[model samples]
Target: MKKVIIIGAGLAGSYLATQLPQNYDITIITKASAQDSNSMLAQGGIAASLDPGDNPASHEADTLAAGQHRNKVAAVDQLVHEGPKLIQTLIKQGMPFDHQANGALDFGLEGAHSHHRILHAKGDRTGLALTTFVQSQIEHVHWQENTTAVELLVKNGTCYGVRVRHDPTGTFKTLTADAVVLATGGLGNLFPLTTNDATITGDGIAIAARAGAKMADMAFMQFHPTLLSLHGKCFGLISEAVRGAGAILVDENNTPIMAAVPKKDLAPRDVVARHLTWWRAAGHQTFLDISAIPDFPKRFPGITANLDRHHVPFRTTNRIPIQPGAHFMMGGVQADLAAQTSIKRLFAIGEVACNGVHGANRLASNSLLDCLVSAEEATKVIAALEPAVTPALPQDPTTIVPPKLPSLADLRQAAWHNLGVERTKAQLHDFHTWLAQFNYRDLVPTQLSPKDFTIANLCLCAELIDTAALKEPKSIGAHYIKEVAHESTAS
Candidate 1:
């Protein structure tokens, strides 16, 4: 049996494992337990044109529009054409989705959709439900929990395996395989306030870049406009479905923030996030006025539960205080439709890999769809690959001593201020200068602890985004740069 190693146990990795041929020996390595992922925290439903009024063409159009037409036409076409069938297959395979009283699949509406085709499972717990369903179906898989993949074991430009650290015990081990799959999620934790799970620290993308893999669209990080904010910190996300259901974003004076913006509450994520950021910068507190949405507790039970846990008086006031938080990364290790990166035998799926399907900004709930479609395509290609052959790995002649790096807290805070929402050239340049102090762009440290490895990975990925942002000074999509702001301020 050919040995296949999969990094990450989230929806992408877990679902990919089940789809791979039974002949392959599969092992899944994750930084935390399977449940601790952005996948499990996802409340947004999956997007598919399941209704009679909806079609793949329309779905593709909406995706392109949301991505600001920056999406790869071919990849978007494939996702739209193939996603519905895959979703239906999952439904037939006992994937429990919410159904109406008429027993029809209950699809919800979200931002940037031309049709009501966002399929949710168990109300607002779609991510948790989907993760549970896929994980329960995985069999004949080896799981390495509490472990971190520190480096890719590549020889002669071909990936054979990975060097991982067991986080708890601090022991290192090399797991060799015929092909390596990177399903690790995005670098949301790079920002101080994010909707991402703490485990998502850009490890996979960092390791890939260090292994000489090509990266793309590294500057387009999406900020969700409605994370529940208390004091100055964000706690949980208020799904876009809430706005689709009838809630409106309002300032402290009860004036609708999006009233003047095109598409208003239904605008693409980038627009809404930018507007929210500007509104806040102008000294206004933003919130989601939920009074228009009837039966909020029933419609958003999960969000309601979290609000209650956080001691918010949403039940009485019908308003949810909100702010934009770094929610998704539209840029990552560049991969193709088959989830193959530029490097051979290295496949990337889910948020970790960018195929231009999401373009510069992701449509609501298309994330789960991308995870499904790409994983299925990757399985077909991986099954046809030959067995692994252990090759002699090269060792570096010089080892640089570790430099004093910023604390993870400090690093996250810096990234949030410098790289968040609207970035200026001055901010990017200064952030790049500070990050240059501990550059690991060329070296993947094997001598560091797991925590240091994470910090190193974050630093490397931050530089990648900083460089990419500096290269493109023009504002486009989620990579909005206030060049004039910097120029005027500098002068």
Candidate 2:
């Protein structure tokens, strides 16, 4: 049997494990339990051309427009075209999707969606529902929890396996496989305020880069326009679906903030985030006015529960204190439609793979569909690959450590200030200098603790993002570089 090791236990990995052929031995390695994934925290629904009035062509056009026409045409085409069939398959297989009183599938709307093609389950708990459903179907796969992959095992330009450490016990082990797939999610944890799960510390991307895997679109990090923020700390995400339900961004005085911007509250995520960044920087508190949306609590029970836990009274007051927070990364190891990366026998799926579907900015609810579609595509190629001999492990000394290590809080703070929503050349240079203090790029230490490894990975990912941001000076999509205005002196 061909052994396959899949990193990450999110929707992509779980779904891929269930779809692979019987000849392949699948093993999933996760940093935490199966539930500790960004997929579980995703409040938005899956986007697909499921509605009678909607079609793949319309979906593709909306995706391209949201991506600023920078998306790979073929990749976008494949994602939209294949999405409906996959959704139908999931539905036929007993996936519980939200339905109207008439027993028809209830299609929701999100920003940039021209049609109500977004599918949800259990109200705002779509991700949780989908993740649990896919995980239930996974069988015949070895599960390794609390295992962090420190490095990818590559020999002669082909990835063969991974070196892992049981995070709690710190026991190291090397697992060799015929094929390795990275289903790890995005790098939202690089910033202080984020909507990402705790396990999403950019480990997969850093490990891939250190393994000499090609990366792409490293600069595009999407900030959600409205995360429930209390005193600058993120409480939780307020899904864009709320905005689609007639909520508007407003100031403390109940004045609409998006009134001047085209599309108003329904503008693309990057555009809305940019506005919120400037608005907050100008010392104004922003809020989401949800008074117009009928039956708020009944429609968004998950959000209502979160607000109740945080003691935010949504029923009496129709406003939600909001701020832009790091939500998703639109970049990672470069992969094709087949989910094949630059390295042979190695694949990247889900948020870890920049397959050009979400070019500059991701369309709302498209990420979940991307995960399922990519996993399906990857299963086909992985099942076809012939088994190969396990490559010999490297004999080099594995104790290379960085000279300087900053505290996790310090690193996150720096990332938030410099690489957050509005980035400038000065900010990028400052962040680059802060990252340069830790000469960790060249040193791939294999003996550090999981916490130390997380720090190192964050540093390396930060440097890559900084470098990419510096390379592209022009503003487009999510990578908005603000120009520092120079005051004219009396000359």
- How many clashes in each candidate? 0, 0
Clashes of 1: 0
Q: Could you tell me every candidate's TM-score relative to the true structure?
A: 0.96, 0.97
Clashing pairs in 2: none
RMSD of each: 3.1, 3.7
State the C-alpha lDDT per candidate: 0.88, 0.89
| Model 2 spans > 4 angstroms off | 396-403, 484-491
Error of 1 at 182 (Å): 0.2
Name the lDDT value of residue 258 in candidate 1. 88
Candidate 1, overall lDDT? 0.88
Candidate 1 wrongly placed segments (more than 4 Å): 396-400, 442-444, 484-491
Prediction 1 TM-score vs. true: 0.96
Candidate 2 lowest-lDDT run of ten? 482-491
Q: Write the per-residue lDDT of candidate 1 for residues 1-491, one digit (tens) a residue.
A: 88889999889999999998776789999998988999999997999999888899999999988887889999999999999998888888999999999998888998888899999987899999998999999999999999888889888889988988888888888888888999999999898778889899999999999999999999889999999999989898999999999999999899999888777898888888888999999999999999997788898899999999999998788899999999999999999999999888999999999999998789999999999888999998898887767788766436666656778998988998899998889999999999988745645467776677788889988899999989875777788887642211100
